[model samples]
Target: MAIPKRFEESFADITALATRFGENEAAYLSSKYQEAEVRQDFLDKFWLALGWDIYHQEHPNPYEREVKIEKSVMVGDRGKRADYAFYTAPNFLQARFMAEAKKPSRQLENQYDCFQAMRYGWNSNTPLAVLTDFEQFIVLDSRYKPTVERSLSGILEKFHYTEFGDEEAFRKLYYLFSRESVGNNSLEKYVEGLKKAKGKKTAKAAPAVQIQPVGDTFLSELDVHRENLARAFKRSNNELDGEELTEITQRTLDRLVFIRFLEDKLVEPSDIIDRLGKKSGSPWRDFANEIPRLNQVYNGIIFKPHAILDSPNFAPNNKTFDEVLAWLSHKNSAYDFNSIPIHILGSIYERFLGKTIIVSDKRAKVEEKPEVRKAGGVYYTPEYIVRYIVENTIGKLVEGKTPDEIAKMRFADIACGSGSFLLGIFDYLIKYHVDWYSGGARTLLSARLRSSA
Candidate 1:
């Protein structure tokens, strides 16, 4: 493949600038200015050379800027900012890449630099993060975790401007980055190829049995939708208080998740979101009208039998609904109801149930329940933990017994918050009975199980 003459020229100029700056100004940079100021100065020129309109001047249109410097995101109490975030389009909301810059004198290969960039990229759900100073550039795949043990050696690439003219090296950098490639997701494919080349070693290292939860990613995106939903509801109904806003958001999440799960399962009325997406007016009303039908289909998960769907439309307006739906429908959703383990939902909900969403001054947010905090924070018992207790207590009594032999098994939980343990026990009983009957001389265990059920 031929390198474009224009990009070649830009690279030449950038390499020349980098060489001169390294020789002349690298040593004095640390003494003259702080990290923030150096980052701004380098990014203003470096990003522009890479075909990014960092200042939004090339495209004067508000939504047409190739790059945006949005306000810092608050991870918790402290606010952290990405030095340069690049978007696939002029729309800033479609951010696809991130760049974190360090002072020219600071080592870009340190764990701190790599970890910080990785966190910001993962938080934004971007494919790649660039950690660079004027002298060196390191590209990190943000999908994977970075560890201090590896330093920056695990990154996708690390190179200096001294080799900018090497065709193979330049091609490697350009193919994986170059604005056009990153925007088209070719970069992601390239990174995935690298991971795949390692074969089963990598797969074995990160197996399904590892028990890593997607809860953080799910909760983060859920929180975003929750905030957006609350704001939209408040705008539509000013009389809503913080508590009301929280309740409505919680119900909305429940309804949406239930509908999405059923849709994925190909249950009846499987296209609720699809149908709702096609409509023009407020979607919540349509959903409300269908509540009775949904309740019948889903066994009353979304709506209870005599419950009233709040008037004035409990649904978000069109724009908000579209945005929220788009977020939920992203290609890499945290949890896929179809393939995810059933108990994983209960595990996630266990943590969720330990908290409540409250609006502080009309801004709905999640807060840990006071009792949960006093009891040493939200802790979800692992499925194995629940299984152990159930097997010992419930398992022994039911041994050597047929479904008909055992008329009924009684169990109780004094402190049942989310009923995850209870569900585990119920599942145990059912499985034990099914296995016992099937392994026995009975050829028609299906009928026996159905009768017991």
Candidate 2:
């Protein structure tokens, strides 16, 4: 049935509810309406303005009939009629939520009483409870769905009943209640779960690939193959010239080996010895020597075959070998300083490691592709990135120095590639420095400090 607009017993009525009583009853209610609860007054006015059919079971008559509220399923049984309940619109004459008004002076620490009143409407999806002392109103819900709010816009969600009438206060309350407003807020877990689900779904929508864990069997064979190749790669041409080569490490075998070289790459022998503090038979002996008996240790491991980009025709670039070595071992692991170019090291990693499979996206990308930038030659450092690093690491150190003086500090790069940013800083300083012993020395000094920093 089509319900009438709010407060209508039927559509033909457009009259004050207070008019239904006799002269004496009307007079008493009229007086009571003026001086009764200010909270009731404000709440009544506010909800009435929102087009609600407002009423009070405890009216002036003191003998009005009691009305029962619909109970919520989740609430099970703790449900009762509230002092007030406002229906959303006439069509939904069913109450959207209920409110229990307390005197402005009533001490109300336990919010469960207020929620119990609203739980009466749980049969319908939107079961809500609100308590007001006029000065403050608290809203509670069994409606698992959370509400969002922002300061710029009061209550980003539709419900702003409690926060209305005072826009500024409402705005602050809006942000105070966000599910993710605080770093350690309890609601953060729920929000994070949703985010992780979305991320997984997005990844699934992109592409996919197979990934079988490469075990020790695979790793051993690969390591043996790598050290064998490294031995050849490192030696002079004359050492390999006269010897009848076996090509025992075939392309197919190398490909299989390359795939796992990264996983089993040995750590520095020196570190193991350092930690053990010098031992005779401790697994440290194999690595503690001049050559670090890596070849024999890995050669003993046999690889069980599996497939993906595995075939006979693989000859790895020299750089890839070093990158894998660098990754498996630390930067300083190789005691020699003048070994090989950093770019070549990165290139080796790009070569043998193989492409990463975007399992969710259903695609595989070659390791040498996009994410890996060769040459280490950056075009420029973006201002925000530079400023952030400067602020955190160097800005405090160089705070008062003139730009000219700051430009000449010494630095070193752990993995410097053509030093583009260093070059950029040099260019910037040349424009500002008024006095310099020589431009080259100033530029070199500027580049040096940046590297170490």
Q: Find the candidate with the highest TM-score and give its number.
A: 1
Candidate 1: deviation at residue 43, Å? 52
Q: Model 1, which residues run further than 4 Å from truth?
A: 1-212, 299-301, 305-309, 313-317, 330-334, 439-453
Candidate 1 has what TM-score? 0.49
What is candidate 2's lDDT per residue for 253-346, written digit by digit as tens?
3433332232212222233222221344322222223122443444433322322112223223345443443333322121211112222233
Model 1: clashing residue pairs? Answer: 284-315
Q: Please, what are the lDDT tens digits per residue for candidate 1 over residues 1-453?
A: 122235675476556656666676756356555556655555566565555566666554444456766443433232356767677652334357777776666666887678777655654556677888766788886664334444365488887866665657766776666666666787669767766786656765654222123455566567777777777777666677766666777777788777767754445434576466345455655666766777665575446643223564344556887777665551323333533345556656677666666655545566777898899877777666777788788777776666776666567888876686788777766666666654642445556577889
Off by over 4 Å in 2: 1-40, 53-80, 89-93, 121-125, 144-165, 170-453
Candidate 2 whole-model C-alpha lDDT, 0 to 1: 0.34
